[model samples]
Target: MTTLQWTPRTDAPRALVVRDGHARLGPAQATEMFLPFLEQAGFEVQVAESSEIYADRAVMERTDLIVQCVATSAISDAALRGLLDAVEHGTGLAGWHRGIADAYRNSSDYLQLIGGQFVSRPAAPDEERGTDESDRSRCYTVDLTDEGRTHEIMAGLEDFTLRTEPYWVLTDDLNDVLATTTYAARPDDPWHRPITSPAVWTRRWGDGRVFVATPGHSLVVLRDAHVRAIIQRGMLWASRPAAAA
Candidate 1:
C-alpha cells in the first residue's frame, strides 16, 4: 500500500514555466510574453532553468500549474517521474506547439501523459515552391468543434485562420479535441488524401488536467488574440483548484 502525504494549497497558485529547449523563439522571448500575464493572473510564477526542477517534490507539491515550452530536449527518469507524480496529484500541465507536442521525444511515459506526438508537418512539394516560398507558410483555418465553442478555454470563439507551420500530429482518442486543422494533399505529395490533426486539445491525467494548442511556432502566432487567449485560459483551466477553506 502507498501512503499519500498531504500538501497545503496556497491562495495564489504557483506556476512553473519551463522554457529549456531548442526553438526559434528563445527562452527570453517566451518568458517575456508569458511571465507578466501569469503575474497579472495572481500566480507566483517561477521560470525553471531546466526540466530538472520537475523532480523537486517540495516545489512540485505547491505547484498549481506548469507552463512548459521545452522542445526536443531530454528529461531524466527522476524528473519525468516527479512531473508525472505532481500532475497525478493535482498539478496542471499546459503548453503550445513544440513546447508540449514535440518534447521528450524519447520518453513514452511523457507521450502517454500528454496523449499526442508530433509526426511531421508535411510541406508543399518542391515543384510548388515559389521565389518567396509562400507555399511553405500557407494559410489554413483552425476549425472549432462543437465542444470547443462551449469549452471554458474557447467559449464563444469562432474559427480562425493562421499562416504558419501547420503541424501534423499523431494523437490519441483520449484527448478531448477542441479544434482541428486539415492538410490538403498536393499532387507531388505521397498521400492521396487529406490529413487532419488536432489544433487544440485537453486531457484528464489523474487529478490533473493537460492542455495543448499546436499553433505557437513563433511570437507572431502567439500574439494572435485567439491563440493568446486560448493559451492563457488553458493555463488557468489546467491548474489545480484551490482547496475549500
Candidate 2:
C-alpha cells in the first residue's frame, strides 16, 4: 500500500476545530496528538479547551471540521445550536470511542446529529468501580470488511491488532461499516450470547458527515500504524465537502 500524499486546497485551507468537552481522558494529551496530525495532513487545526464549543462564535463559523472529544454531558444551549447549525450547513464531525458516542447522553438532537450512542458493553461485566488505571487491557484483532478495503479512509490498510478496551456499542443507524471485531461470551456471562461489534462506521446527519471508530481508548491504540491510517482517512472524509451545501 502506498503512503497517502495530501495535496492542499488552495481556495482556503481546510479548518478543523477540536473540542475536549469531557475532560475524562486528559484534555492536553488529546489536543497534542490530534493538532499535529491534522496539520501534517494539510488542515489548519484550532484547539478549543472550553466545555461549551458554541461560545466561540468566530471559531464556530469558520470551522470546516469539528472533532469532539467530549463524553456524555450537558452542553450549553448555544454550543449545541452552533454545532448543529454548522453541520446542517455542512461542517464535518468525527471522533472515536466514547468521545462522540457518549456525548450528549440526554439530548435526542445531539444523538440524531451523530447517529449513535454507547448503549452498553454486554460482553464485559459492568465494573462497579468504573474504568480505572488497573482495568485489564487486552489485545484484539480488527477485521476490515471488503468495503473498508475499498474506501479511501481504509484503503491500503491490512488487518491489524491493538491493545485497548474493546468497546461493544449498540446502534442501528450506521450507514457504512468499515470494520468490526468478534466477541465471544464467557460461560459465566449473563448478558449477550455472542456478537460481532462494529469498530468503525460512517453515517450522514443532515448535510454533515459523521465518522466514528470505537477503538481509540488509549494513546497506544491511536498510535498504531493501521489505527493511525484509519483515523487519518476518517478525519479527512468526515470534514465538510468543499462545495456549497
Candidate 3:
C-alpha cells in the first residue's frame, strides 16, 4: 500500500489519517486508497488505526487536517473534547462515505460537528428480510448543485451516476449541499415515489471546514476518475497549503 512516486509539496501539509471501526464499511480500504493519494498530492500523512489521535494534543496542534475513515466507533470523552477543541480552533476535518456521516451513532456532539447522521438505508421492501431498500445495490445519479458545479472541490467535475448504497441520512440545512442523488421507489421499495439526498457536501464546525462525499461504498465507484479527482482535491483543500485550484 506504499507508493512514493508522488512527491510531497515543498511545504507539505500535515494530515492525520485515522481509520478504525466497521470492516465492511472500508476504513482500511479507504486508507489504502487515500494514503498514497495524500503522499502524491503533497501531504505528510500520519496513519492511526485507533481513535487516540483525537486526544493527542501535540499531534492535533501541529496537524493541519484530519481524514477520518472510521465508522460506528466511540471515542473517549477527553478525546472527543480534544478533537472538538482542535477543530473549533481551525484544524480542518474531511472524510468520505461512512467515515464521517455514519460513525459514532450515539455521539450527538460528534453528529453536530459533522452536521448529519446516518439513520437507515431506506430499505426497499423485501419479504424475506421484511424491510425494503436495505443496502441493496442500485443505480443513483449525482447531480451537482449550481454552486457545486463551480466550487473548488467540485470544479470541472460533471454530474455522474454511481451504482451503490443510497444511504438514508438525517441532515439539517447547515450543510451546503453540493451534489445530490435521486432514488425512485422501485415496485419493491416502501415509498410509492422517489427521494433525494445529499451525495456530497461541505459544512462548518467553528472555524474549521468539513467536506464529505456520500457515495463511496465500493472500489469501482470510488475509483472513477471523476470521483477520485474530487476526493483528492477535497482532502488537499481541507488541509492548508493545498495545491492551486
Per TM-score, the best of the predicted structures is 1
For residue 82, what is the lDDT in candidate 3?
A: 74
What candidate 2 gets wrong by more than 4 Å, as runs, is 1-11, 21-24, 55-57, 122-133
Whole-model lDDT, candidate 2?
0.71
lDDT of 2 by residue, 7-36 (tens): 334455455555565666654675477777
lDDT of 2 at 190: 61
lDDT by residue (1-245, candidate 3, tens digit) is: 21112233346578898999988877887668878877887667899998877887777767778999888888878778877877776678888888888887777898988887767675533432334534576665789999898889998888887766678777899998888877667686667877878888888777678888887788777788878887878876666444411
Task: Report the Cα lDDT for residue 39, model 2.
Answer: 87
lDDT for each residue of candidate 1 in 1-245, tens digit (9 for 90 to 100): 23234467556888999888895647558667988989998899988879999878788877889999899899998889889888888889999999899999989999999999988877954654568854456678999998898999998799999988888999899999999999889887888999999999999998889999999988888999999999999998998887710
Alpha carbon lDDT at 122, candidate 1? 75
Candidate 3 minimal-lDDT segment of 10 residues: 1-10
| Superposition-based RMSD of candidate 3 using all C-alpha atoms, in angstroms | 6.6
lDDT of each: 0.87, 0.71, 0.77
Error of 2 at 68 (Å): 1.2
TM-score, structure 3 vs. true:
0.85
Candidate order (TM-score): 1, 3, 2
Q: After superposition, how far is residue 11 of candidate 3 from its true place, in Å?
A: 5.9
